[model samples]
Target: MTLRVYLFVFKSRGYIHIVNIFNQMSSDGVTKYKYEYIIVGAGTAGQTIAAGLPSKDVLILEAGGYTTSLLDIPILTPILQKSDFDWSYETVPQPNSCLGLRQQRSRWPMGKGYGGSQILNNMIWNVGHHEDYRGWFSPEEDYNYERDILPYFRESEAEHQPTILKHRTKLAEAFMNATKEYGYDDSFKVPHLTQRNGKRWNMAHENHENNLSHHLVLNAFVMHLLFDRTSINRVTGLVYEKNGFEFEILATKGVILSAGAIGTPLILLSSGIGPKKELINTTVTFRKDLPVGHNLQDHVTTGLDLILLNDTLGMRPWEVFTLNSFYQYFVNGDGPLTMNGCEVVGFLNSTNKSKNWDLGFMVLPIGASADAGIHFKQILNIKDNTWSQYFDPLTSQQSVSILPILLHPKSRGQITLKDDVILIDPKYLTHEDDVDLIVTGIRIIEQLIEMPSMRRLGAELNPKPFPGCENYEFASNAYWKCYVRHLTLTAFHPVGTCKMGSSDDQSSVVNREFQVIGIENLFVVDASVMPNLPSGNPNAAVAMLAKKFLSVLLQSHREKPTNYDI
Candidate 1:
């Protein structure tokens, strides 16, 4: 039988639609499909929730177009970093980092397309130390890693090799053995490698390829939440806009906001679900006066660039032979295609007093160009925009950038709305501890470069000239601090704008169950709900949270029917 298909593209607003040949029957004898859940933002957390949920009518609303280009999914991040897929958010003037660089806008690289940030990010899979969670929720709460969250972690992970899996088990055993000997267990199991079939398993593409029954919509921006007052504080539907025209999607059960840190809070504030004083000033009417856009946190990262004498371990052709490797991957599911760049990592404390490291180190096999700063600068539109024009003036030379992250910064920032637009003014390093932590972190990287593995690679520090370093004292702590302030940027782990906590907790926006406190049927299940930033990359934690919250939503559904009048 010959089939007819219709495709629609909205030019002015950038949206596309596909009308299939087969017409499926609905209850009203119409050829349409209705959804039980409508999820907004098909990014990291959004993709997870969509994949984990049971077989139901699910619809995902994303604002960006789709692309399957190899350039869109490059193994080395610099290629993708310069692509148009990144959202590229810039920070307001950070006084601590960038040497008083005005509007030192860092490249946020939130994927504007299908896979979300995972599609555009560095693709590093870090879970951080177990104590990071304990420190955030301990003594007062009954949240235990082994009892509550470990099984979910195991379920979600798909390790690369059996030997690697065995090594993880051995690491756990070693920690236990050390505890028996020293009467104290401080170390925790590192995160299982997040590779699928030897390739970086972007959750969006994974779902689309594996789960054919699911519906994944790209370039559909959710503009507002549709509420039914008769249902008593429940979100019955959603009002989304595509190509300048608004459409309503009725959800039989719930609407899940799995949009990441920035998107989630911005949606809430735009939907009139934020601080009373702030909402009253804007055109959006007040729905809930909760702290929707407060408690912003992100890991501050600074890079120590080192020039390598030999081609021992810096961007080699074998490391990122994309086209050939991808062809091999599709045929046999093996090769360099499976690697996520960051192979080895270490978590250590800069000071001897702390048990866990507030600083992290990621080892990249290849060195980037000295002009690497140009990629970040262009992506964020730093020069043409309001931000200061600061780029590495040095000529293009091969150098490895050792990224040191300030894991537990004391400084806090906020995301507020002005004239209905999302304004991210992350007041980075306003506190003395944040500055000190970053400084100490720089010292730690200096020590790591002295390691046998790095030394063998002939890694020599790049003595690049900076504004205040006229003396060229490379080893001096003062010189290092000057460099850190000028180079430090976000680790791409912005979180906690819509924190989850108890009612009395003034900083809390959502509750323990991930529901917005004041708003009925409104819940946030993304990185924004985190009370604090984790000590490492947040991708794993964000996915784990989505799984945990899915269970919570299901249990709540089972215990209490949605039809019941509250």
Candidate 2:
């Protein structure tokens, strides 16, 4: 394919960012070549596509650097959140919940490097139940959980032991027993994650050591897609900033935006692909009048922590911090560090709600003591002592957390432009129905704690409500409402900002095929294209989209035989 490239060198802030063409050769000072495919954002979703394509013809651009050894162990997931491995996104002040947090902002930890959230997530792998995808406008379109998504899930999963849950604490056992008694399901299973032999296996592993993709560019930030802006608005390539320099690369076939939900809309808006009124203030020229950043949704959550009345119930906090604990994991992958913090989860319908509004219960082995809560507060970006209500005094006692994830929130939020920076407002629990569900979920957790099995383990609610909700009678529905309003946190599963629908859908940015409407040779393959957030974590769902995107895009590019008629 004929190609054109222009390298622009510049400096931003105090660092240098250089942009380079994938086909640029070291032997020649100047080289010009067009890539067959350009995949923006080298996260988990992008790697799924890159791994299947011919290595030399594809080029992937990632914003973060390489993966570090710290990510190899599942337990170190939290430590990587604020480190350079993370994108370090902080939300604007939420007027609704987290009232006692320092600035009322929630810290969103997105992985900046290769694996994306795979590098920072709890690593519990699930594509969600088939029912979660049953009610879509067209079940065959993208919501085929059993027929489509689950196949890809099985392909990528490795089932080896030295299993993730090596040390099943008393706390986890109690939660599982509660699920059993409550009859949420007949059997309880530990979390399924992308791991092998007790170590974290991320998406980058698909492309790095394999010859599936030729060019992998890290520390590369995509600015926007380049389009002709003619009648059809055909996309040609993209402009990116690498190191301290800016450059543009041409695509022969197409460019796919696999940037996560937040990153996808930012690039779209910056490229003038969103509602024109929002882009009027930006310098980038308008390209498409699609509702790019609308319909943003996420899984919102709140939790109940119980300081075990049984001192001998689990390992003590001091025992958890000692050197022997470290030895247990490092020397033998068989201790606290052997597992992801969330080893078990339960799915249930909230009281008086349909199965559509499901609730997820995840067990946290660490309690809210100063030592344990520090990790959570830093990750949640909670500044004040509001979370202190959940903590027990730093004594011999150990605690565990049972939090509920709000599935299918009717509440709608958005990712928009605040000046040039992306603005996120999840608008958690804005709907009365959503609040009802969360309150119901909290009640469910309470019931589980009171069950014969869980009660035997010393699980009891703190009667004193959080500080902000003290005006209401403690443990009443009103009190729980206030408590939920102040303590709400995201499950970190955001989707549907750039929605996918048929071409006539005024609100959809992309069509059922995942191609950006009103534009040619450009598509979005990440969570942004989800019509609705999946019932569980969206990582597996996003990977399914990548598979479909690759299959369709490549099939269209296949050459016709000379004997065939036009």
Candidate 3:
């Protein structure tokens, strides 16, 4: 017998569609239908929330399509980034960095499909310092935020304790073992392999299974939030389009905008919930005008590329495409299938006198200058000739890249509307202090590379020919600074667009509870609400926030008395 389950209808770009699924039961006569939850975007944070939520209905509205090929996994991220799955966003050319660099495209790899950017990202998991979050609220507070959040981090991780390698020929295993032994494991926990029995564990699939009460509709793009000003001034529902038709989804309880930093603010500004002056000046109907798209923040990453004496540490072409590898993945669910491009990470302050590590770095065993944009385009089949523009033989190479990331940038940018369309000016490196932090970070990495442990592995300095240095002065602080400005890019951890704080804080867009000040039943739960960028990767923090919000929701539900008499 065949069973049909009806899910909600949603809009995408400019289309509308009603989604449903049909299931065929087995001979045992036991069958279960998935729940539905309307989740927008299947990126890192989105997928984490979907996977962790309790069993209920889930409906994910993704503007992108689905992934069916192994090429979509993290191992092939360098190649997959050039495809259509990536938004391929380019920043307005700045006078500071990428001076000689072409077009200044930021290479915003927001995956357009089920797995979101997780499918195309470097996949390095680094949770920021505990003090980073608590510091934002109050510098005097001694609360153990790390202890509170560590459990949430552990909940998401699937640890692997393998024996240390001794004179191993396998590059992947050696890299993992070396990182574990070199004090890297004690700094922060690595993310559990997102593969289920060898296959990529697309969070959309897991979230759907856990949350059966809600429905996830792929290829659905939300355009605006429908608000009811006549009653309670609360958000009523969302209006979206899919398949060239428009439809409205009415929310009974509340409207939670879990869209990432970029998409969340874009949707709000489009719905007339931004700065009042801007909305009144535009064609949009004004609502709150509460600075919805202000204070944009992102981590700026600069790298030092070092050529290794041995090529044994990187992936071979045969490893990428071989019958033996595929058989191992499909049958035993092992081999290179479990690898997530980035395997080692470190977080430390550029200056030891600082409160905590402001500088963060991740180790990638492959070439540093691979075309991140072109890599995504090929995977999603987005036709474009721009791939050749950024490809340069001299700059790109097959060597391990050590990236130094500035966690707390004093420089802040903004997102505004141009004829009601999203326009972002990341405004990277605007402040001298921000630039100094990044410059100091590069010097730190240089020291790390020259350490006894790393040098023993035969690490070589990058930019074989320094622009302003003599042959012997390759690794000077000044030379590193020049290279950093030209090569540094966003870490893709944009936040603070809709900051959270007390009502008195002018910079705050939402309260500590994540509720928008002027509106009821409306909350911002993604990275956009971060008052400041964390010291490391923001994905784990985003997941922890989701769990924290759910806990508050459950506690509130239990406290309220239910009335049975009608």
Q: Best lDDT goes to which candidate?
A: 2
lDDT of 2: 0.70
**Candidate 1, overall lDDT?**
0.61
* lDDT by residue (tens digit), candidate 1, 1-566: 00110110012012211111011111111123457777888877778788767645677877665645342323535445534555666666666655434356555667676777777565555666666665233333676888666665555554211112111112223223432353323432233454455444477767777764556665566777876776435676677766556677777666789778888887887777889998999998678778887888888866634333343332344333557766766666555544455444556675767655687655444433333333334553343321222234322334555566788778788888897777777777678677677777666555545554445555566665544454657757677666666666676789899988886677788887788886666678888988888776887777777777878877887898565222
Error of 2 at 182 (Å): 3.4
In order, how many clashes per candidate? 9, 12, 59
The list of candidate 2 runs beyond 4 A from truth reads 1-33, 135-148, 158-164, 211-213, 229-232, 304-308, 312-332, 351-357, 370-374, 385-396, 558-566
lDDT of 3 by residue, 294-363 (tens): 8888888855344453444534333343576667666776555445555566676656777777777666
Models sorted by lDDT, best on top: 2, 1, 3
Error of 2 at 487 (Å): 0.5
TM-score of every candidate: 0.80, 0.87, 0.79
**Two-way lDDT contest, 1 vs 2, winner:** 2
lDDT to native, each model: 0.61, 0.70, 0.59
RMSD of each: 8.2, 8.2, 8.5
Output the TM-score of candidate 2.
0.87
Candidate achieving the largest TM-score: 2
Give the worst 10-residue stretch by lDDT in candidate 2: 1-10
What TM-score would you give candidate 3 relative to the actual structure? 0.79
When sorted by TM-score, best at the front, the candidate numbers are 2, 1, 3
Per-residue lDDT, model 2, residue 135, is: 30
